[model samples]
Target: MRYLIYICFLISFTINSQESIDAALINSTDIKIDQIVALDNFETFYYLQDNILYKQNKDGTSINYSNYQLGEMSTANAFNSLKINLFYQDFNLVIILDNRLAEIFKIDFNTAQPYKNVSYVSTGFDNTLWVFNIDFQQLELYDYKTNKTRFSAIPVQSIVLSLESDYNYCWLLTENYLYQYNYFGSMISKIENTGFTQISKSNGHLILKKEDTLYFKHKKKEDILPINLPKLLINQFLLTNETLYIYDLEKLHKYQLKIN
Candidate 1:
């Protein structure tokens, strides 16, 4: 009787542990996408396909915008409803688009002297841009209208992997560390990297992907929880609030996270 009780306890513990870590696959849909830009809401998302930017609404309606001269879009940052910065690394230009998928303006980085080698760009506060100066290995807040750098951080030591920002803060992900900076270009916080390749932020929580595993943590907390994904050949994934969207080249999987 004692042995049976112990066995049952072990099995129950294992089951509970797995349940705590795993994400529940709520639904999945067929999707062909090269990259995902924004999860505007639970049902709507924006993606890139064949050099064209598309906004897929909740009701399966899609509105697309494209600029043939811009070449392929390298990255896009939808900082707010009013501003979306789309960077074309090959063309050395950044195109500003509104929420309705209308092109507002384009900034040719080639004309921005002394900071020509811009590898990445993100939307900053008050019509400014957070750009990674690849030539100088520094992060700069550039004003397109004035054609001047409003603020510049010291050269980073590691190779920058990605850049993200909102109206109040900017986050830089390097090969060695994750850095958070204020709008004034002052480093506010730094977290040591634990072999993460990609990151996404929503509602004060940070989601990181390293290898095939996903991890989640709060902005001010140190505890990291491993989020288990359903078995699939994942190309990339994104987290919006408590929902996780996994893209496997051909289909997009949606999971509802209940990590405790």
Candidate 2:
């Protein structure tokens, strides 16, 4: 694991640089959302409202799913568009949804053998899930079919803030640190979070956001570059592929993330 430190321009929590990257405004859409939920690669918007999960597509079509019995949806992972994982942390339950928003299956952690008190979950490779078992203080590659743990990472005593994973890697973000682990349960890199509040992966790169500035971390690069962005009210934001979506609760602004 390596730590790379760069000259971070911290002037009142905003990156001030003449050679800053440009975020070209592409389009704007008016949507009523508390926060920016997620905008998929296909330009589909996924939003959770009043216990119902809505999928609004670009073709003027939408679908929704809801289960009041499970309580509110804690999070929705649309990493795998074909199979979406909707987790309800309150009841430790997960509902898998198909592309058409149809319920495929449900995973109840309460009745699960071995009894894992999972606090976080995300889509994983080949019918598996990246589950953060709070009881064990570790992240596990869990296979729901066999109800077995494929691989478990080392325990972290700190509170896990966010978890993002691809097929080969799982990234765990804590209060002051961000860790990357491989499928073999090996820790790859441990980078200080440096005031970051959220984690989003797009095109094999990480787009880290703080208060008003956004940082970029390419997969092959060790340095974290601050994305030069204009000051705007960002209640929530999503960096998907070449586009960046910023929502101020009432409208969604789409921009192209052009890195210098």
Candidate 3:
């Protein structure tokens, strides 16, 4: 499929509001985590500490998986819950795990037929994955089952800070702009970046973190609203189901997102 390039200038970008939403201190769990990955459900979540992946449940039972030979576990995505994705960027490897944290499939991009230099990866629909090919500097919706690239988007011109995608859309955040694409390889929109270091997507809304501050953007609105967070050290965070989860290496904090 051919990629449609849609250029967005700074003049077209505007913030919807300067107001900040409040983030209540729902509760802070005393835990050890290097980074927060994803929420499997209300009672279960996954995290990485000391390069080992852990799935912690509210009942105190937890499961973990580790592979030290892969260098470091760059990121873990629990988007599908059952089919968890573990990306080892240094090795160009992606491992799919079962709900019980059992190894199921391994995709080594370095040795794959076409040889993809993948710098980032996230879960996608129907045995597919959102892969950022560093070789071409382009984003692709890759089908892992058939070992084929279904569609590829335009090349990103700047350094990609983060990559977030759901089933239908993918958002690529670069140094200069935040680009959004659909399932058909079409450029949906591009927003000028103020200074977001990380991003989390859920229900068509974005929870963006610039340094230690957080902001929210709606799917149908242009307003980028600031989210007022309590004074807590934030090392990594994830947003799921209108709930915000933060991990500061020592404790995990939970907050309910109240949006107007």
Candidate 4:
């Protein structure tokens, strides 16, 4: 009996150790960060949709122009310093904004046979965009810099809620489920939760908000903890460093949490 009890303790400790997030802050003071322009890392910044990218710092700022516009943004692979956006006027365009959210290049679809009537729409991922031609009838992947199809596949017609990309994973959210894909556009995993309304990733953890409650899951843990949240409906959330920033309507709320 004693042996069995000892074994059980080991297992539980291992599980707890493996499934935790180190909450760095909680209920921190809320600061009114303005213009926002664009926010990336501790340095690069962008504001207003313009041809210029802004180099930002705690004490200084500067701007440089790119040939294209930043459509969608990717914050995960920070080293790539890439931004993806779509534009279609005379041609189907997919623009890549640099890490600094400045300087741009585009992929032109007007010259391609398969690209006729194609429009580039942005998913939530930075450096990633969704290519749909003819009213969501066809969907494909558009890489920002190469301005080419990284992979092409048909999307199930549904109301999409959000999209995001990490260095190795791409996440797509619909009303009923969350589908995770690899950089090559292959399906990796799917989680079904009809109550899911919005999601955000910071650092390496995923924070999902359903109804009025916020839930945090670190890696593959099958359990969820009900975290306290405000009365406002979350417009969006961003996980930066170890801080959780919740955007409600026009205001932003910051929370500190320990994952472990």
> In lDDT terms, which candidate is top?
3
- Each candidate structure's TM-score, on Cα atoms with residue i matched to residue i, is 0.86, 0.87, 0.89, 0.66
Q: Between the candidate structures 2 and 3, which one is better when assessed by TM-score?
A: 3
Order candidates by lDDT, high to low.
3, 1, 2, 4
Task: Give the per-residue lDDT digits (tens) of candidate 2, residues 1-260.
Answer: 12222334244235334344567888888888654457876778888788788889999799988889888789888778778999999999899999898989889889999888999898788889999999989989888888888888888878888888877788888876899887776889999878887777876678777878877777876677777666777777777887878787777888897753
Which tens-of-lDDT digit does each residue in 163-187 have in candidate 1? 8777788888999988888888899
Candidate 3: which stretches are off by over 4 Å?
Answer: 1-18
Q: Pick the candidate with the highest TM-score.
A: 3
**TM-score comparison, 1 vs 4, better candidate:** 1
In candidate 3, what are the lDDT values of residues 117-173, reduced to their tens digit? 999898788888999999899999998889999998888899989998888888999
Candidate 2 stretches greater than 4 Å from native: 1-20
- lDDT assessment of candidate 4: 0.56
Alpha-carbon deviation at 162 in model 1, angstroms = 1.4
Candidate 4: segments with Cα more than 4 A from true spot: 1-55, 60-92, 99-101, 109-113, 116-139, 143-148, 222-224, 230-233, 249-251
lDDT of candidate 4 over 36-151, digit per residue (tens): 33345663544323333344565665644444443433221232445534244444454555655553655566665445455335443555565555545444666645556677
List runs of model 1 lying over 4 Å from the truth. Answer: 1-22
What's every prediction's RMSD, in angstroms?
5.5, 6.7, 8.6, 5.4
- Residue 53: error of model 3 in Å? 1.4
Q: What is the full ranking by TM-score, best candidate first?
A: 3, 2, 1, 4
